[model samples]
Each structure stands twice: as C-alpha cells, then as structure tokens.
Target: MKITSLCILAIGLAGSARLLPSQPQDEQAKSSATVEGVFVDQDGAPLEGVHVLNRIWPGAESSTESDGDGHFEILLEWDGNKDGTWYEGYARKEGRAMLKFRADLRAGQEFDFGRLTLTPGGVLSGEVLDASGAPLSGAMLLVVDAAQQASAPEGAQADGPPWEQVIDRGSTDASGAYEIIGVPPGTWFIVAKHESTWWLWSEPIRLEAGKRATASPFHLESLPAEYQIQGRVVDPGDKPVANAQVATSVLSPDGRFMMQTTARTDESGQFVLFFSRLPSGTVDLRVQPEGDELDDGSLLDVSPGARDLVVHLGGTKVLRLHVVDDTGRPVERYGWGLSIDKPGSFVMTGSAPAFHEGGYATLRVPEHPFELEIRSDAHDRKEIGAFTPDALPKVLEITLTSSQAISGYVTFQGRPVPDVFVELVQRTPNYLDGVVEGHWNGLYYGLESSTTHTDQSGRFRIPNDFPHITYYARAWADGYAEGTSGPVKVGATGVHVELGVGGEIAGVVSVPRGLPPGGIELEFYREEIKASSINTSVGKILRTITDDDGSYSQPHLDPGTWLVRVHPSGTLLSDLGWSEAKVEAESHPYVVTVQDQDTTYFDIALGRDEPCILEGRISVGDKIREGYSELLLEGPFALDLDFSGVDEHGRFRLVARSSGKYRLVINAGPGHHQYKTITDLVELVPGTNAWERDLPVDQWTGEGIRLDAH
Candidate 1:
C-alpha cells in the first residue's frame, strides 16, 4: 500500500502496515498481472533501462531498462488469497523514477493492461567566467529557480522541487573554462559569490532541450569602503590574551543590530578590523574568548556621539559558584543565569554562565560590588549577595528546594490524538539569545526528552518538577481545533489539567462529470509564526500526502488557513489533450480559513483541449533516439517538458506542440545518455503542427553519477 497522511500522523507502531485491504483466497491462483510502463520528463515518452521493485512480494523485482524505443514491461502473480490478503505495489529507491501498478485478481485470472510512462528530470549546463574572459576559479554559485510559487495544503510541503536546487560546485581549470550540468529545466538565477562578503550575480537564465545558450561575460567589482577600528584582549592578571574572539555588529537606523563577523586576537592581544564597505555608522564591538569568563563590566565609550571610532578592553576576572541541596551535595544539572547590578545603579545585565566540574562560572569584579541572580530549569530564579573582584573566585555552595509539577491530557472529539504537539510558555520580562526583550522565547522545558504522544485512551502527562516557576500549556492537532490551559503556578508539586475535544474537517472529493483524463496528486503545508532556521517540532509540518480522494479521511488538522492543489498526472498532460487552466474558485485561487468546530467543502473540475502533436529527434555516437514531447503553458508563459527518447545510428524524432518558449527537456536510453537544454528563450509559431531539433547523447566513460538521486 502507498504511504498515507494518517499513517504519518499516527505515531510509530501504527505506521508499519505495508498493504491495504486484501483480496479473497480464490483469486490467488491467477497466472499473471499486467505491469505499467515508465516515461521520462513531464512528457509521456518511454524511459528505457531502469530498475523496478515490488514491495509486497519478496524477491519479486523486474528490470526491462527500455529498448531504443523506450518501451518495456514485466509479469507478476496477483491472484487473490482465500483469507482476502491484499497485494501492495511499490518501486525501490533506485526505481523511484518509474511508476508501479496494483492488480485485482482471482485464481486462473489473466491481466493484460499495458502502457506506463516515466519521465526523467532535465539538466542545465553553463560556465562561470571572469572579466578577462577567463573562467573564475573557486567561485561559489547559488541557483534559485522560480518554482517556489505553489501553495500546498496544511502539513504537506515540497522541498523546493527539481527545478530548484544548489545544483553545482567546482573550481575552474587552468584553461579558464567551466561547465555545471545536471539542472532541472526551469528559470534560474545564478549568483557568483566571492569569499563570504564580495560577490556578483547574473541575470536569470532558462534552459530548453538539446541546446546550449551562452551567457554574456560577467564581472565582479569590489565595493568602496572607509574608516577602521581596533581593540585588544587581556586576562585578570592584566596579561595580553591571544586567540580571543572579537566582533563588531553595527546597528541599523531601525535600532536592530545585524549579525557580526568574528575575528581572532593576535599574539600581542591586539586586533585591527577594516570597517570600510560598511556605511558610516555607530558600531558595537564585543570581545570574548571561548574558554575565558569576564567580570561584570560596561562598554567603554571612546567618542561620544560619534558614528565611527576606536575602543580598548581592560583585563577580565572570573568567578565560580555552586548551588546544591541542604545536604551539601552539588546540584546536578539545571538552567542557570546571572544578573549584575552595581551599587547605586539601576542598570543590570543578565547572563547564563557555563557549568563546570563542581559549580557554575561567572565574572568577578575586582574591588567592586555587584549582585547575582541564579535560575534553573523549571525552577524560580534567586538573587544572591554583591561582591567585588578582590573577593575569592569560589563562592559558598548551597541548596534550593524543588518546585511543584503540572500535567495534562488532550483529545479531539473523544479520541486521543497521539501526535498532538504541546508547549509550555511564560510571558515575562526576560532576555533571550543575548537580546534584552523579545516575544515568547522558543524554549520549552523537557520538550526534547519528553514523550509527545497520547496513549490509546488519549491520555498525556507533563511533569513539572522544578523550584518556583509558573507556566501555561498549549496543545494542537492537525485538522482539529487547538486548545490552551490557564496559567498554573508550581510551588511544590505538579498540577493536573485536561483539554476539551476539538472539531474536525471531513468531506469527500466530489468530482464533476466527464472528469479529465489524468491521475491527480495533493499536497499540504502549514503557516509559520516566527522566523527560525533551527530544527524544532514547533512550526514544522506534521504530515503530507501525494494521494487523496478515497473512502478514508485524514484527521487532526488544527484550526488555521489551508491550501490544496491538484497536480494532474504527468502522463495525461503529455499524451492526451488537456486545457492548461489554473485551479481557482470565483476567479481567484481558493482561500480557506478554518476555525474551531468548523467543517468545509471543496470540489474540483478538470479542463479539456483539442489534440495536437510535436516532433523532435536526438543523436549520440552513431545512435539515434526518437519520442514524443509535452508542453505546459501558464498565462503568457509556457514552461517545463517531459519526453523519453532513444538514440541508435546517431539520430532520432519526438512529437508535441510547435509554439511558445517551452522548457524543452529530453533524455536518452542506457546505450549512451545525452541530455541538455537551452536557457535562452525560443519562440515557436502555432498552426505548423510540427517542430524539429537535433541533440547529442554523450557516451559514458565510467564517470561518476551524472544526476543526483531525486
């Protein structure tokens, strides 16, 4: 059976099913079942010389690897079992480019269904050159395609499709020429980056089948700069500290500091940084070493009201602290942070110190007084006495009592949602990621190690074992409403809570009569709240599906905005006549807003068109391959192609449309694989009923993988 969205959201054990509903015993004696054909590209042309695997039956694999005509097939046993055992179909990773077909059979039954198509992805090749017409060596390039425009249903996401990828990387040869191939046919932007700072970009390029488009010579010019800054680092004994890291983050006019670059201190503890290139402005230089701790201090302003200037750092001292229980045993592990406030001053800076062997680390102010605040995971923060740098680095060890715990269970419509996501947050005046004030920090106590599933009965528990912190719990499930609990204060033990059952979205896909000829696929995606590159379950997709519209219905979708798109089978689009009409409702793409207890309905209609044919041919080393071509049009733009062809005697003609700047993509069989495209736009007038182009299939000399595993 094919993987489903429900399986993805059902947690672990329940996802192991490899087959759908089975067939009856009498059907098990069938002599054979028909297999589907595979094509290359979005176009329905034959794909020759490829592997195929059967998931349900062990040792049942087939290899036809197409002939020069891109056509082949295999036989399989599909008779039903007495106990109604079902037959499952699937292709192994190596055969992913090919499609699998299932069979309904009985004893002595014979299946003869034929014709399956597979489309191989297209490729793009080009060179990066310098001002003097020489290839640029070691130039880092980034390619971004224009295909990031689709909106998927909630929880399902596509990793920037084939048309988009970081497709190539290599240094130029001494001859000053470079070639980056193996890119999917589409519109792409090429950016040549120099080091991490200096760089340049080329205008967007488009690629077509069997052609090479040359780009005008590109150049990289350095940005102008002005002014400079310097600084130094030292240890508590006033000795120069080498190898310390120092950085400068200039603030924007909007008061936000951009990310800074790090530089190391020299053997003399001194450092110099050129601030040219950067617009004239006030910049903050922060210095620190990986292993060294600093005593409480303030930024020393060198020039008041000046946008640019120099500054120096004095030596720093370290302080050590230990927090434990009344029994005098050291505190094992917990979150710890500190705050420094000088005498007669309202200013204070909070910091989280690194924990070592017997205690925690902090900065000690020599001959000065400062206060300290200590906090732990799930525990309330505590303030300690002020001390000067003259004081000993080690402070007295002590203990703090534990806090209360809170727990909860969440369900939807009387059923426990196993994969429900939960979070505990505290809204307070706090510092996070070195920033003084921001909305709820993306931190959840015990989240990483905690079990995030509800039992069969829909029961869940969150143990809050800490020392005086307060929190609120929030839970969410896809396709259902989300719920949150009131704030709970934990003084000594945990508190219990339960959430109400939420609403669900259920509806069958009712298609219009005379449905178009094509297999359809669906995908989903959720909305994001905040910007973050780090990995966390929060804001990430919970599930997705490549198929829908059967008796089964997916559940547990949280209330929010959802989008759904219909991707018709590449086969029908390539072989049959289908009007290229965008999917929309009321003249605009459908927009759905889901809420608690809300249920919605949606039905789709497919468009049709008059039949047309296009022709093309290719060649590679005394071999010729011929096949059909397909073109997908969008508004005034027609992009993307899928065609399978073969090469024998060095020539071959495929058929399709004869108009628009189509993303012409073609592939050859096992003999000699030759694939290439033209990024430069091309125009083909309609009513001609024909188009012809010649291509070359390069022979394999035992080279590495030409295309990445999609």
Candidate 2:
C-alpha cells in the first residue's frame, strides 16, 4: 500500500508539473514557489474537479482545479519577506468534505503533498410539509452541531453556532424535499423554519462519514396571524407628539427574553408594532415620547390578532440648571452629564458649552414623576427620585466643590519607570453588601476617576474633580509589577507610587501523545493577602495561551504569591472523552512566589492521569435554581471549570483531571453578590463521580466553607 501510494503521488506530481507555465528565471528566483498535490477519496480513487487553494502569504492566494487524474499544481508568489515557514493548503469537492493541511517550505521551495484523501461528507435529507400535509416549499433547513445544543437551556432553540459552525444549510425545493451536502461527520440537530410557520427541531442524529442520514419529515405548524399594535402619541392638549420612540419586550418561544420590533412615531405621531411570533405569556410594552415617559405601560395580550393603542404624553417642562465652582465661577473645564431612570432613558452630556449661556443649561422634560441623576467630575453625584418637572425650582443650582489634583512619581527598584499608566480608582462603598452573601473580602472598585501616563521623568498627574472621595493611585508598566499608593484624598498633593520590579514565570505545557499542538491555556492569579490593605484589581491577572511548541510565559507578575493553572480549551477537553464537572476540586493550586526582577520556571504535563466527570446540583433552601456555576480546582494542580444551563431542577456537570483535590466555587450568576465557596477537598478517582448538596441561601456565606466529603 505504501509503495502504491508513493507511486501515485509521484505520478500526480509529474502530471501537475507539465501543466505549469514556464516562468523567467529572474521572476522565479524572486517570487515563485510550487505547490503540487493529489486529491483522492477515502477509497484511494482519484477525485476530479476538486478545488485547491494555497494561502501562504497575505494578499497572495493561489487557486486551481484538480485535473481528471486529481492532480493539481499552483504557483504561489512569496512576498518581500520570507520569514514565514508554513503555508496552509485546502481542498474540497462538491460532494466531499473539505481537507486542510499545512506544509513547511522555504522561499522558492517546491512542495509536493502525497495522497491527500478527502473524507466523504455526510448527507442530510428530509421533507418539509405544512400542517395540512402539503409540501412546504422554501422552508429553510439548518444543521446545528449537537454540542451547542447540549449547553443551551432546555426548550431554547439553539441558533446553530456562528456561520462557520453550520454544518450545512438548504431550502426545500418545490416538492418540499431538501438535501444538504458536505456535512462533516458528527452529531447534529436539524431545524426547519418556514415563513408563516413556527420553527421545528429534530431529535439528535449521529452521522457517519460518507453516510446519508434521513430525518423524519418536518410538519411545521402555522403560526397565528401576526398581531399589530397601532398607536398614536399625543400631548395633554390632544396635539400629536411626533418622533416618539416605542419599545416592548416579549418572551421568545425558547423561554428567553427578546426585544419586539421597535418603531418610531411619524410626523403625525402615528406608529405601529408588528409581532410575527408572540410568546405564550403576557408582553410588557413601554412607550417613551421624544422627552417624556409613559408612566402607565400596557401589559399586552398579543393573542388577539390586532389592536390599537393611544398614549397620552404629559406636557413638557424646561428645567434650567446652573453649575458653578466654589469660587462662584462657571465650572467650565469639567465633564458633566445627566441621566433619567426610565426605560429608553436619554443622557444629555457635554462640556462647559452646555452651560455656555451664563453657566445655565436648559433641559426639556416631561412633567411626570421620575428619577434624575446629575453627575460632574468635580462634584459629588446627585440622585433625585420622584421629582416632578413642574415642582422643580425655576433654576436648579449645582455646586461643583471637589476640585483637586494628585501628582505622583513612579519608580521601579529605585529607577524611574517612564510611560507607565497611572489611574485613580475609588472603591464603591457597600459594593459587596447584599449582592454577595458570606465573608466576601474581595474589594471591588468603581470605574477609574482619572487616568494619565507618566512622562519621561516618570512623573504623573491625575486631576481629581471630586475631592470628597478617597482614591488609590495605581501605576502599571509593561515590565513592572502593578503598584499602588496608600489611600490618598482626592485633594491631597504629591502622591508617590513605588512600583516593584516585576517577575516572570516561564513554563512548558506538555500535551499527551496523539494530541494536536496548541489550545492549552495558562492562567496566573495573584494571591489575595488577607492582611494587605491594597487590593489588586481582577484585570491584573495574567493569562496566556501555549505556543505551537507547548511553551508559555506569564511575564511582569507582581512580587507576591501567585496561583498558576493550565487547562485545555473547552473543545479539546470535550473531545478527549471527558465529561463536564459540576464542582472543581480545591486542594492543589500551584503556588509560587517571585522576587523583584526574577524569573521562575515551572513545567506541567497533562494526560498522564485519567480524567473524570463531576455532576451535582446547587439548591437554595431545598429549591433548585437554574443558573451557572464556576468550579475552581486547587490541589497538586489547578484548573477552572465553568458550567452553565443548570436545569430548573438545578443540576450541573463539569470535567476535571482525576487524582486531584479541588475547590469548587459556585456562583448563581455573574453577580458577585451571591456565591458559595467550597473549601472541603473533593477527591476524584479515575471515573465518573457525583455529588449532591442543598445550600441554604441564607446560611451559606460568601466565605470559603469547608464541607466534609460525604
């Protein structure tokens, strides 16, 4: 077989060589390279009419068609630089799956690919019919990857992955027969949709290479007549209010919230909302005029085909705001903005130009009860609730009192660090209260108040507009550890930041034999010191992906205890026969400490031990909530696992490497307010393991609690 394959490849190369055009010696020496290949099917038969493409350099692509003997040759042009050592080649035919291969070639090198076999693609065929048993032409058929469906919430229609993930797509013919070609072998779900009908999904189907899978005929149920809600916006005086915006939220059939079609009122204040498909429950409709709010929104029952709506907008009131600094002068050089607490709220912002006319800014708003917030960089943020425009004073006075400047110098190991980014950040008071339960000690700060870059002298200045607030002056450079100053009052002067010479962590991510290169990710987390007054922002954590050679570096790490972890990408893990885990073991986080300007080296090997799956449920006071959980593994090794779409019954699953202890941190959602940190070590053997627990909502604190393994 090997001799025959080599002979066939040699024949293909010789035949392809004859088809190449003779080029000038000078041109060939400067830019020409040859890529010759033979296209064959799984049965080793020559496949003709195969399209071949060579993408070796930017803006230069060579393309050709396979001859009758499946021999193809293309001459590629090498750009000015010849540093690139690899080029990608692709081949595909009408009925066969596409094949991608990479070849290493030097400049002017002639590359010859041996017999490249194109796997026969799977075929999906089915018929589409309406409720009346008549063929439904033009019905769209989509093949979605089953893996995407596995993560989607139950009852939610999975929009087949991104355009690239679509295995195949087609439309039914006049006879309602649909056939999709060139689908890669895998498990997939078929979805059919037609105009005027509801979407229908098929059960999962496993397709084999070069095989055909027939799906049960889809009988799409006709959707009810689309409902239209027509309305007109008028002022209290019965005059039309033109250019008003209307919006409404509707639940999709998949049990997810989606926005309804929005429409703006025309010149005559006329608007219409069309609903092609309405959810089973009530829909909430909100209307906002050009500058007014609709206090009484409509709870629409869209089941009744069409209806008319009328919204009465209250009269408008002009509120004049006067802003001035403590010196009684117009606060001209500060950023100011205002926001309303209503749906489709509008924000009016600008510089001193907004208050140009004698330091007074005018605003036109509805004469209704609403919440308003006015904020300024040089003043405290003010929130007014239930304020009626008509009841406001003729001129509202806003005092800008907090104007200060903080200047600092950043240095690393007694040497000035120039071009470092300096920022003033304030901690949001009570940010962790109520939102996070338990002993949540992680400090969360608000957005940056002021930002600046250090000059050549390593000097930075942050002009603070809110003097009443205290902030931390943080400094970070490309090759230095993040440094921060002690709490400095906004009005404080001469704040200095001493940055530590950062360290580097170099490591090799060794993958098991038979695994392709790349896809391994490394994450480094700086340990939080309980006694330290300075809190590192989450953004400071370092993450990197392994190179093709399985090496990675976490550079410029702070001089402190840090956690290092290595894990395969989600797709790779799933492909390795590992099931998702619900909780991560917390016992073996790789801990390392670094000194100033030092480099640490560590190596990790994967695939030696078998992997296991952990499944469990998260419940609050006996009731399971449908949410996601983040499992943090710590032991002899560390990894992070994220699981989503816990059913309404509160079940979840995660995958982990076996023979390791893990710490599982489960958060109901992204919000840090509610979470459970499990410190008790969960040991996983080489196989499937399960755990179940009911976390009392009120009893579980955000602190890491040790739970004895049951």
Candidate 3:
C-alpha cells in the first residue's frame, strides 16, 4: 500500500497510517488495552452517561458508554509510537467539570481507576446579537480559562488579557440566548463566533464556586454576501452536460489545505457554487459519464471570475481490459477494485470500476493521462504504467502474478517487540509502479491493505495481496519510538525493523504576571523536504498544552529543528480558550532542536514588547466581491498578526513583533496558482512602529500546491 504519503508530517501514526493493524498477534488479537472506571458527582451519587474516550495518537481510538452506575469500560487496540505511553483521558457530562486526566496505559493490559470523582461546575449565560440589534441564532460561544494561550481576533479590544483552554462551550438558541453549564469556576472570557465571519471575545467574566454568571451581550457586525461561481458545464460538441460535479480546493500559499466547497450542475448544465468566503486557489471542474450518454471530462486550471463561465469537458472513451495471472490463468477478484488515476490531476478523477472473479473490466474514462491499476486480492497487485489516450489499445491484456505474503519482525534495542503495527508505504514515485496519487501530497498505491501486526515473537505478515512496488517498512507500537526500514520491494522475505528511543521537548510557558494570561495552545511543525516537490511539507511531531502549572512536554519527536507556535488541536492542533493561533514571544518558527534520546528544554514567554504593524491593501482583480475576503495575509508563522482578518476591501493590518525583513506569503486565490518565494514586502522595525503599503496584487504569482513532478 503505497500511500504517496503526501502529508508526511503526519509522521508515523499522527494521520499517516490507518489506526488498526491488518493482522494482530496473541493479546493484540484480543484487546490491546482496557481502561475501566467509575464516575461519581461531588455529592457521591453516580454520574451516569458520561462520555469516556481513549485518546490515542497514531493509534486506534475508541470510546465507551458509562453504565447506569457511572462505570465505563473502554477497550483499545493501540499502534502508538511510545510504549506505556501517558495519554490524555477525557470524560464529559453536562453540568460537570470536564475531566482531562493523564492516564498510564500499556498495551495488552487492563487498569482500573477504582473511583473517579468529578467536580460540580458553574453556569454562564449570555446573548448574541447582530449589528441590526436583532438576536443572532446559531452562534457558538465558549468560555476560556484566563491562563491558557489564546490569540485575539481582529478588532478585539487590546486591553483585555490573553486566554487558554475552554472551560465550557454552547450554542445560541432561536432567541440568540445561551446558557453554558459545566464551566470551571475561575476568571474567563466569553468568545462569540460564527465561522470565519464573526469571531471576537469579551473582556472577562469571573465566576465563583457552583454559581451562575451573566456575561455582557455580544454584538457582531453584519456579514456580506458569499462568493458564488456561476457557470455551465458543456460537452465537446457545445451541448450542455448536466449533473456534472464542480469542485475547488482552498489552499494556503504554502500549499496547506484550508478547506473545500463543491457544487453540482442542475438539469440545464448550469451550476451556482457558493462559498462563505471566496477561496484563494484555482477552481477545477469535472463531468463523469451519465448512463451511456456522456463520458468524464476535465477543466484543468481555472481562476473563477465574477460573471458567466463555461466548462468544456473532454468526453470519455471506451476501454476493455482482460486481466490474468502470470501463468495465463484468469485472475480472481478478492474484492479489490480497479480505477484510472490521472496522477497529477487536482480534482477527484476516474470512474470506480470493479472486477468479478473473471477479472474483466469495461469502463468509460476521461481522455486524460492516466495509469491503470488492478488492486485485486487474489493477484499480485498490478500497475499498468501510464498511457496517453491515443496510445492505449482498444482492448488491453495485462498479466498479474500470484499474490505473495510479506513477513517481518519488529525489534527495539535488539529485542523482539510484540503487537507492533507494521505497514508498507511508498518510498518514491514510480510511474510503472502506480499512478501518481497526489503531487504535493505524494504518491502511493493505497493505504491500509499492506498492513499487519507483530505477534509475541515479533513476526508480522502482510497477507499476500499487494502490488509489486517499492515500499518503506514502517513499524510502531505504544511505549517505543516509531521505526521505518529503507525501501524494499514487495514479496521480499524476512523484512525487519529496529526501533529507536526518540527524543523529547519540554518547557515552561510564562506570561507577564500582571498582564493578560499564560497562553492557550502550542503547535510546532517539523521541517522536511517532500520527496516529490523538493519543497517543505509539514506535519506535527507532538501535541500538548500548557498545564495549569505552566509546563508542557512533547515526546517521540523525530530529531530535527521544529517551528513552535500556539496553534489549535486537530489541525491534533489547540486554544487560550483560543479559536485562533497565537504567535509566541519568540521569533517566528521559534526554532528548537531536538535529538534522539535527549530532552530539549525550551521555555517561552507570552506577550512581548509592543508589536510592529505592517499594513497593506490588496488590489487584486475584482474576483473577490464586496462584504467578503478571499485573500489571506501571512508569513511563515505570524507572531501577533491576525492574518485571518483581510476585510472585504482587501485591506489588512498586521500587528507583528520581530518579524525581521520578510515578505509575507499573500495566499491570493487568483492571479497565480504556483508559488515562487517573495521577499521583503515589509521591513518590520523595532518596538511600537507601523508601516503601510498597497500591494500590486496582479504582480504576485505562485506555484500551485499540487505536485507537478512524478
């Protein structure tokens, strides 16, 4: 299973590999770990129906229901990087303090927390209103602790203190009123938000033990009309092609995925696509064959415009394939399917064709540069190389080899380790090996099929059902570091992995004692050049938050320089009760070096001296309509700048600290889709100063995030 591994920063199980192993050994074949616990309220009564979850990273995550007696029994099958790792245990129930305890969990073991008690929490009530003085329903609200790291929203009063961890969250009702229970008693702030348009926080709200507090009503500005792409999809003959799929990807200037919104054409072959905010990347559209009528089509690169647009699709062609084993016998389908992949295409391409036991496929495909893949279980997975539309024969005959099994052992410090997850991954792009899965994302045959687990003796078997491709054998287990072997071909014998003791980064986060707060989140990205683009592709090595004591630590980080910032969770990213990321006191990319088997100590402070302001207005084409912003202003890791706030007029103000002389990556969706680094757009001088410039939006061009190389 060559996954192209495009998001390699997912490093290990972060998001790279599947959560479960294909084959399990001994105890793993059973349950990897069991955590049992009983929950009670401060009054000693059973707190039934608490949500208990086993939080595992790069591993399987499972949750359990609490019995009427408040007892929860969570079972887990872990493929984690570290052994006997300490993971965050979460339990939540309305009107109760959310429990975030660190628990020691070892695979193949059962631990019971005899009696767990939860604290009774207070409640906070508030109302949200739009600029018209009318109630705004469906608005989300959260109360954040005063000490956690949190970046303020644009236009938020600068006089208020910073914040961290959400004590509680709730949504507004039809009356635009909200009441959030289970709030930990302390000093906090009320944050009212509605997607990207309206997000801002209150001054502060103080609550006492088991009490109720009312916050000041929140008033937000009116939002503008959303961006829309109105167009018609047509066939090569100039006839309307209805029911086609039109999609576009939103990516950061550095090629980071931002979001995606799609629309489907109606009966007239006309489509209207709307985005809450205009996207900053080229839009792509495709038309799949409609019952025996039209075939698939493509609209490669298109910069959406404000008016009428037409999409001419390349119609489909007929293709017949007869697949057989190397011995001239017809291949049997073990349920694996077949598909045509345009390796470099951005939008989802090709029709999903399947094969029965006879191994024959007759499918219509868009006339694009694509490779054929026969991913059947009973045969050695076949990759039929790339073929141009005119170069393909009317009927193609391909021979596959009998499927072969892959066996391997996992060892750490020369000792066999059981229950480790082992999977095969692509090491490089090979046209003859498989289609290019994704250019910027990397290329791979598939994910999860070529995966298995080690048994007590540390042996794993990838069931004999993978294509003959080069792959890196990666092994991981809880309580130890993840390990990967150099590239090896399929059907190789005695594949082995030797795990290592990875390094750690530990530190304390501080703030001006009398000032705002400590901070809410901490996210750091490891630097590694993507094999496909020779450009930086990112992933988080470790995820952690500053504890109440102001200390934080990240384990199992691959040795390298990492850029640390106060980003959110799941992006495993974080908050000060923060929805936005905060640039820390240090310089951007706050570089820290971590080495194998060593612990790097690095402390950080919150709130620096007054920041430097870099102000600019973007004059890109009128692609972005009024009352909306489709532009993003950002550098590597913006310190104090609120990059999310590029107003409808394309005007932006960046409050930065020590950014040096650097040009920010203006992720303008139009004008250019490819990137060539820009420099010195603004020279940020020392404390409390401001600089302004009007951007020549048309002059900016970039390499699109998609991988163009093989």
- Measured by TM-score, the strongest candidate is 2
Worst 10 residues of 3 by lDDT: 1-10
**lDDT, candidates in the order shown:** 0.40, 0.59, 0.55
Ranking 1 against 3 by TM-score, winner: 3
Specify the highest-lDDT model's number.
2
lDDT by residue (1-710, candidate 1, tens digit) is 11110100001111110111111111223335444545343464554544344422322344434455554455555322221122344322122222445654322222223345443322333455554555655444445554542321222111112323444332333443334333345665555533222455455677554334334444543322333455566665666667766555443334454434445678877765443135354555555543424432223332213333322333335555667744565553333333333343333444332233354433433234556666554233566676555665455454654334455566655545665666565543322112212323222332432224444455544445543766666665554445656576543223233444333333433334443432344333232222122223442333222233522133444555444434444343434343443221111112234455555554434332121334444343343333323332322212223233434432323222223443333333334334222111234453234434333435322221122111
lDDT score of residue 454 within candidate 3: 79
Report how far off residue 281 is in candidate 1 (Å). 4.8
Quote each prediction's TM-score.
0.35, 0.45, 0.41
**Any runs in candidate 3 off by more than 4 Å, and if so which?**
1-36, 42-45, 51-65, 73-90, 101-114, 133-138, 147-179, 223-323, 328-369, 375-381, 385-397, 402-710
Task: Give the lDDT of residue 352 in candidate 3.
Answer: 21
Using TM-score as the measure, what is the rank order of every candidate, best first? 2, 3, 1
- Give candidate 2 regions above 4 Å deviation: 1-121, 125-139, 142-191, 198-249, 253-256, 259-274, 278-407, 412-418, 424-452, 455-471, 506-523, 527-539, 543-555, 567-589, 599-710
lDDT by residue (tens digit), candidate 3, 587-686: 3435566789999998876554445556555544453222211111233222223343445565555554444554343333323432222223456665
Candidate 2 worst ten-residue window by lDDT: 1-10
State residue 152's C-alpha deviation in candidate 2, in Å.
Answer: 22
Q: Would you give me the overall lDDT of model 3? A: 0.55
Per-residue lDDT of model 2, residues 1-710, tens digit only: 00000000000111100011111111222356677877888787899988765676543456788999888888776643232345777665656766778865544555566567888776778899998999997677767898877742233232323446555566788888877666788888887876546667888888887787889888877765455567777777777777766666555555544545566789888877655455455554555554333222233344434455677655556666677767797753233333333334432322221223445655554444555555554354555555666588877787655445777788877778788878787643422234333423223343434666787798876666676877788887766678878698766766788887588888777755566646466767643222122443333555687888888887777765567666465234434544332113322245566666888887766655445666877666643444555455443223343344566676777656445665555545323344444433566666777878766657555443456533
